[model samples]
Target: MIIRRFSGIILLAASLAACNQPQGADDAAGKAAAEQPLTAVTATLPAVYYDSLQVTMSAYYQLSAALVKADTMGADMAAAALKYHLDSLPVARTGLDSSRVAQLAGQASGISAELEGMLIDKNGLDGRRLAFQMVSDQLYDLLRVTPLKNTAIFRQYCPMAFDNRGAHWLSDKTEIVNPYFGDEMLHCGSVTDTLRF
Candidate 1:
């Protein structure tokens, strides 16, 4: 681990040093070429859906991090942001059939409702945590029906959560960061399922 860190630092320093060097005309032209945005290729799924869904996913990750820290206020704020994005997600623009689009929209609304519940419950952090389980489940179901392009989603579970009743959460990575237990047992979960399409 230490060696890897040292090697990474060396590589970063090399990159920084390279950046400070004077660039020739050829180098400038090459840089400009590299900076050009690649045109979106035609795919079965629409690119607009991917971009909009990415924003919602980013907000979901922020909520997950807040929960991992046991910060109720932060979690509430993040969840509010997530709910806002979820409510605004463009299911109609996803290029799915009418029935599929309706299903996806319903699932998104379900997750948004859970977030609202988490935000309003008098039970505070526990309520938020409780609602998160359903939110995760709804997300998993949504993904199973409506696949996202070039994305891998992990369904992680903590068996020790809620007195061994077990609960599942979706993560973009396989690493186990238990949101249910927070710092108490951060690594008490495992990746039980992976979805990529």
Candidate 2:
């Protein structure tokens, strides 16, 4: 009877040890996983492409605002802005066929020409506004697709460029935070927010 009791106690202890061993191993694994750095996933867009897209979008908004206000000074500023943006477009051959690059550049050129006309003509407000809206719509549509393709590229290549710099687009007379590390919050509009005529 005593031998039976001793054997039972030894079996129970062994069972408990076996159970505890797995728990310890699991705990260690959990800790290791927690400590591991988040593996940076690739973005869909390259930094150059992403940045160019962002700049063009920003210029579109600015030009649209100028058109609505009939602010000649604003329009002039936007012309320079648009020119600068167009100049900054990524020209590097990123495996894209020449035909595709030419097509994109042609679209950009058309937008630039519209902006130049708006700036040059004193009475081109109505025509300018229409052109601005058309260009803005086209760019936004392109962006919807561009955002997905370049997501991994932008995240991996340009972390700062992916941040929200146009948060003020929804607010009425709100200050917009600069995306590229600036102290000033640019004063933007809620006009685009409503999408109303």
Question: Which candidate leads in lDDT?
Answer: 1
Worst 10 residues of 1 by lDDT: 34-43
lDDT of 1 by residue, 1-197 (tens): 99999999997676445323333457447645764322322347677777777788888888888889988988999899999988988888877668767767877998999998888884777788888888887777666665667889888877656765667788998887889888777776777678887
Which residue pairs collide in model 1, if any?
none
lDDT of each: 0.77, 0.45
Q: Backbone clash tally for model 1?
A: 0
Model 2 lDDT per residue over 1-197, tens place: 99999999997666434322222346447745764322222334456776775676566557645644666578668767976786566744334557655655665576566666666775555455444544553443334334423222110011121132111111123333222222221221112222211
Q: What is the total number of backbone clashes in candidate 2?
A: 11
